[model samples]
Target: MESHERIQAACDFLLQSPPGEINDVLNDVRNIISDDELLQEGIVPALKRYNLAQFITVDVPETNHQSIISEAARLSTGSEDEESQERWLDPRSKKSFVFDHIALEASDPQPFEPNEDFETFRVALEKASLNYLLAHFHDGVSSAFSNQTTPNQFILQVVANKYNPTNFWSGRWRSEYIVDLNDHTIKGTILVNVHYYEQGNVQLSTTHSISIALPPAIVTASPESAGTKILALIETEEGKYQNSLNDTYHEMSEKTFKSLRRALPMTRSKLDWEKVLGYKLGAELSSSKGAFTSGFS
Candidate 1:
């Protein structure tokens, strides 16, 4: 399928569909495409490129002091006697017992904490998983575009108010370098970026370029599956058109992946585009003049 067709398919999928229809779209496309590379990379990445932000909320079980200890004992110990002994002797163990609700507040695009407890620590895990999905989507797309796996040169830039200046907090300010220790009202912005080159050179575009914005969240549920869930949504053509796309996706993914591997590595770095580029990818975009132009100026 041509790039134009792909773009049209994406727009159609997004336009008429309600904001809550991510799951059906995913399933509809999933049936049409069999290859994993085509499904993940070509399809999903395309959605993100079109300025979609997926929002999902995970239901976390809140615990108190007693419940935390009980749950920990149930998880860590096999025998009942061992659990009892550990609970009796461990002070830190006692602290672990009382887990409660964690608050993630969006204040100043950062996670702030006035008071923190063990219940709030789970936010770190959630953030990590969210980031992991973002990474996975990128990898899936890069691999699909090219036949080979490419090193993720994409840098995740995140801005938050809380940082550790204390000597003990050294190196903890960076993503993956440090973990989010508190869950109290966590709010922040994360930007994922990558560099694109064509035929061993940057695809310099004096006339037209591409940019992206945050995508909205798509929620899905199944009575047979894990109940309610939210995840990144991707779309593809249906029936014959869908089959054609799958074929193109398979072929293109191999070539794209191979090219990516041979080309320059996308170094892991982040940039604040709003500040550095003086423009947002989606909000401010324009097209080159019609094909009547003779050549590149």
Candidate 2:
């Protein structure tokens, strides 16, 4: 029989056999089709059609060696001299080598969306949104702290008060998640608008926008396995959540104070400062962490 006909017969036999017998049938077929070239030309397409591409490797040739070398040389030297670059650009040059034995592992030929179930996609988006929100809050706090003047207790108190974790815990922010089916990414954003009266005359406002991109692991995982993987990630980070919250709050307090110094320079030491800012911040962070955990769970 022709190589193609034999491969087709093997595929048909395997499809009709019980699931437990597939491995035996595959081994038998592999023994019969001993030639790698014949197997690539005949059996590879059949395996892909059966969703068994992962079981085989096919040798494919790389035809663009000249382009690859030219591009590499151009990038390495950052040079545009055409005459000096002709050696690497010539395909027939004896100095150039062709990568003819490129072996490609079989992968799912279908698009990523079809491989993923909707539930996994939704879970990935939720995770992405939560991560974005927390990261944004953390960065804002860090930025505020880094820009503040040291040893200024009044500024620290003012910043802590203005960025109270309650603002986030109270659900006053806007967030949205988008699943890009084509690109296999979960994109999310968290937005917060802060408006405060500084010195009783000027109203200061700023908008904080945080964005995140999540991988396609959850979406591409089998429905039965995706939830377990997500749970594992959360459990791994559970113990550190509260500590992270506290550190973020500390940084935010410093940042807020710096902003206040620039906006209300004369009132920095004159404003009625809250004496128990530390206690209030701790309580707010604890509350915010609880809210975040509950939402993620």
Candidate 3:
């Protein structure tokens, strides 16, 4: 069948079928297309037309905490490269440390365009994934200490508070697409990991991973409303993390995680898939223009 015809058939099936038969109807659409690439391109838009984007599987499967820590450490110490380090001295400890922050984002500019195809979606997903990795290294000097020291004092406060035992901290933000076109569902994940150090040793680590299921209707819905719903889901996940950690850690980890939550931004901007899709391949994509803001100071 022609691509448009197949899409129309899928839409017609969805419109007439009951909720319980969604899976069967989706499977039939896959069978009719019989091409992974073509199905990914054509059927997805059809699903969106029918308000079924949520059923797509978009996610970031690999989130390596150890890698995040190692990259943050490398950036902080400037061992990997001196130019990458942003040095600062702690006021209380009088010790120099590096503060690095990274953000990862992915987008597609014309995801909803009639001519949008699997290649466009695949490119967007690949770009987002690369950003997820590069986010670990795209460090910037923290604003909190940017103006603290002059040529005379030469010392900058590292930790947010004087009483805190941690002398250094680093944070990374990541967002990616894990699209399973074969399954007829779309999904995404947002990750935030923060590490605290004292005397160059990690004292505490806190992480938040948010899984988002985008409904097909989202493609046609208001971007603002869609973003708000996604952020709400993220906040809900944050609450779950707090509850899960409540009984596990009664002291430092608990206290530090709570403080980190307060420091992080709770709101996010609307995601522009079209712009994200237009990014260059293998480039260090910046999330500053994406939905969420950097939570680390």
The prediction achieving the highest lDDT against the true structure is: 3
The lDDT values for all models are 0.27, 0.35, 0.36
- Candidate 3 has its poorest 10 consecutive residues by lDDT at 152-161
Runs of candidate 3 exceeding 4 Å displacement: 1-166, 175-192, 203-212, 215-220, 242-248, 251-297
Query: lDDT by residue for model 1 over 64-91, one digit each (tens)?
Result: 1111111111122246544222221111
1-297 in candidate 3: lDDT tens per residue? Answer: 678787777667764433223455777877877776766656543453332211211111122111111111121334644523433322112133333221111112111111223333323332333333244234211111111212111111011111222435544333333333234233444334344554554433344444445566643344344334433443455457657756667764668676776443355454455776565532445555343445543
Ranking by TM-score: 3, 2, 1
On residues 1-297, what C-alpha lDDT tens digit does candidate 2 reach at each position?
987788778767555432223355667877887776765566544443432211111211233211122121111123444322222211111122222111222112111121122434334433443343354333211000100121211000001112333332211222223334345432333333333323332222223332223357764666345434543443333324435646766886789666666454475654335756876888999999999999999
Give per-model TM-scores: 0.19, 0.23, 0.25
Give candidate 2 regions above 4 Å deviation. Answer: 1-171, 194-216, 223-297
Which scores higher on lDDT, 2 or 3?
3
The reply for model 1, stretches above 4 Å from the true place, is: 7-16, 46-54, 60-297
Judged by lDDT against the true structure, how good is candidate 2? 0.35
